[model samples]
Target: MPARSYLYVPGHRPDRVPKAAASAADAVIIDLEDAVPVAAKATARAAAAAALRAGSGGTPLWVRVNPGADDLAADLAAVVGPGLAGVWLPKAEPAALARLDDLLTGLERERGLPGGAVPVVALVETAAGVLHAEEVCRAPRVVRLGIGEADLAGELRVRPDPDRTELHGVRLQVVLACAATGLPAPVGPVETNVTDTDRLAHTTATLLRQGFRARTALHPRQVPVINAGFTATAEEVAAAEALLARVPADESTAVDPDGHFLDPAVLRTARETLDRG
Candidate 1:
């Protein structure tokens, strides 16, 4: 999916799901993990499941299921059905994904959906998860990966770094994992500065430069900012289109006024730019 913005709606607040789905976000994730209190998880799961069944206003619907070993089964049972695009396995590790892949396969069949219909988006939020991200990327049914930096900071016992300087290696490792596994470039971590549009846009642009093609948003206002950050600019799209236009059908190279020799590699980049638009 070409999701530029993935908006998160708390499972406990089902009322927000429809609103979020209707927003400019390319996808909406119903969160049953960090957003909901432990005592309210069951109710939140039920609410989120109901919203999924109701439909997503043409937006893809994902569930960020609680991944604790004891509660994972319950979370899966409640949300694994029609309307679920995938699951966001939080604090995800390879062992959990392997188990989830098998269990999700069975659930898909039992629920009358095609096997592997519901893919996974692994959320890497720990130092261990960052180190072994490639393993998680290769896990069965995982389509893409996500950076949960807030939780990762908590795991590391470090304060959240607004500049994300502390996460430089972590982000690089996650990108390398996707590259190694042939998975799509993963979405970046959420930006907590929802109200500060300037900061939000800057952060999203910064992450995009760092190889994050998409980002999760805590609020709907952030969706458009993320989308704009990930989207190709009009000038960029025109340049890409022009570059591709100059390529002869027989050869995949184009030269500019500077006479720099362009190659098939540049052609691929141009196509990707157009695709992003």
Candidate 2:
């Protein structure tokens, strides 16, 4: 199954790394970019390397690398290893991802790892990034796509509504790009209001309906909410199972006891729901 929650721990906070990995989060992303200050870049990079060496307690460990040439070089050099699950490329564009793909290729070979072992999650944060979303999604090693709404709003100079309705179009664009490229649904943006559990759950549900299967989480507290939002509820699973059981073996259509018609499409949806459960 696809990841339901990705908890991001700051690279500089090495103490929190293991804790986050052990959390209920489906994945742990040690952020080396944005979260780490300029003066502490080197320190954060070293800390990230150490965290990778320490192991992830069986949880996937990803690193968000800076987009700059120098920092990208330093970050990948420090963190690329067997423990690394993938790289999150910020401000992702096709060209930058090509460079990243080449770098990761060389690093994998040098580290004696299998070729193409490390995947990438391309983060679209700027107007250019949005416009080139499909290209970025299609880039080598890019296994998934994500939106950085906070940064994108800053770039676009638009303050979104409380529900973030204004960014819906961009989010759909990302979803379409992923679908067009045969990639999984995009990971949703991080909900920064750490204390607002209600809002977090509401927005995560909205994202799930908007074609986002997973969401990046800023706090461990948000992990369960996100995971629950993405997962099929027991009632939903039971309903799907019932629908499937009512279908006739030789027919593409059937009628449930409640007189509801079940067609091929409905059967497919039921199967998908069961699979999700």
Candidate 3:
């Protein structure tokens, strides 16, 4: 899966799965947590499990299971079938991640699924999780991390700033932790103001500049904007190609004919941009 833009649909509403799959989203998240009510947990779990088994049109179906102790075992059991792409562990802490790793291992062996096949997206939403980001990233089968900023802001007592300056340090910590721990760049948090396309695009661009490669979306309309934000521009691709053409692969320390300095880091970045497309 491309994984640049993720669309989250309520798990209890299985009808919405096909619509989300048919959209331009790179991935679809079947949300059992946060979206589904407590009374509907059993129904949503069954619905999500069936959807996972059914599989959508070329779209990977992932489940956001409840992270609480009372629900974790049941939620994981309900959703750990053959077609589950992965699980999203919300409010991720080091201890919880370790416990999930063991549980997933057991479930995989019991179900005859490939061991380590089902990965986890650790949602580092709390101050404690942020402080333990490195340990969380180091946990087995942990693929990537995401920010649940709405919950985090409340925990940190941060006032909502349209400029998002308050979140800068937190985002940097996540990015650095991921880089140091060998995970792909963490997915950016969702933009809440979906109705304002201009604001969505602006926020996406801001996230991109801040080293976020992908983001989550609440609505279908935000998918295109999220994809566009993560993808390298046509001009950027062309420039990278031209740079590679001028410089030999073995020669990372070279200067271009147009007097541009080409260091190893710059060359590596060029290669990554071309690879991203």
Candidate 2's TM-score: 0.96
TM-scores for all candidates?
Answer: 0.95, 0.96, 0.96
The number of clashing residue pairs in each candidate reads 0, 0, 0
Please list the Cα RMSD from the true structure of every candidate, rounded to 1 decimal place: 1.5, 1.4, 1.4
Candidate 2 segments exceeding 4 Å error: 257-259
Candidate 3 structure, TM-score to reference: 0.96
Cα lDDT of model 1 by residue, 1-277, tens digit: 4688899999999999999988999999999988999899989988988998899878999999877777888889998987888899998898889888878888888888887888899999988788789999988899999999888988888775679787787888999899888998899988887899999999888888888899999999998888999989999999999888777888767687778767988888888888888
Looking at model 1, report the run of 10 residues with the lowest lDDT sum.
252-261
Give the runs in model 3 whose Cα sits over 4 Å from its true position: none
| lDDT of each residue in 157-260, candidate 2, tens digit only | 99999888999999999999999999988999999899999999999989988989999999889999988998999999999998888977888999888898
- For model 1, the stretches where C-alpha displacement exceeds 4 angstroms are none
lDDT tens digits by residue: candidate 3, 196-216: 889989998888788788999
